[model samples]
Target: MNKITIFHNPRCGKSRETLKLIQEKVSDDDIEVVKYLEDVPSEEELKNILTMLGVKAGELVRKNEKIWKDNFKGKDFSEDGLIKVMVENPKLIERPIVIKDGKAVIGRPPEQVYSIL
Candidate 1:
């Protein structure tokens, strides 16, 4: 199996569930759990992930986050700007993004991770 990478936030229920599901499907050594909040992705990494997910930078944002709503909501941002925002404020990034090979999926439903796996 290809190595799987999960951009995980342990505090989020969906993220935890997705990680658990990935754990069951993948070997321990093949699973790469990235606690994205503590170790944020760089701009270039985030852009690559967005490409793999077939989403724009803004589409990957968790718009409901307090940090986003207070600081960035209702504002216009270019693609690069949004990527910068997500890189700087990883909490605003969506939870449990699973990537394998060259594809990625946002695990909003936890089951969504299976698609890329």
Candidate 2:
């Protein structure tokens, strides 16, 4: 079976719910949970995730986050710049991104992970 990876945030309710749903579908041994805030992804890795998610770097960002609102909001940033910002501030990256077989889904509602699973 393919390894299922989840970019999880233990503190986030949606992320926790998504992980539970993933656990229901697959065994713990098969799951790769990445606490992205603590173990931030590199620029290349972020780019790969964006490709898998079929979205731009900005699309993966949580614009509502205080970091974005306080620093990045109203700023004009290129795609690479946005990626850099996310790398520097992992909190800006969206939560509970589940990946399987090179495809990714943002588990905003938690149930969104089902489509990829």
Separately for all candidates shown, the number of backbone clashes (residues 3 or more apart, or on different chains) is 0, 0
Score each candidate by Cα lDDT: 0.91, 0.95
In model 1, where is the ten-residue run with the lowest total lDDT? 108-117
Per-residue CA lDDT of model 1 for 1-92, tens digit only, reads 77899999888999999999988988889998899988889999999999999999878988998999899999999999999999989888
- Model 2 bad stretches (over 4 Å): none
TM-score of 1: 0.96
Q: Compared with the true structure, what per-residue lDDT tens digits does model 2 show for residues 22-72?
A: 999899999999999999999999999999999999888899998899998
Collision count of model 1:
0
Q: Superposing every Cα of model 2 onto the true structure, what RMSD results?
A: 0.6
Residue 59 accuracy (lDDT) in model 2:
89
- Lowest lDDT block of 10, candidate 2: 58-67
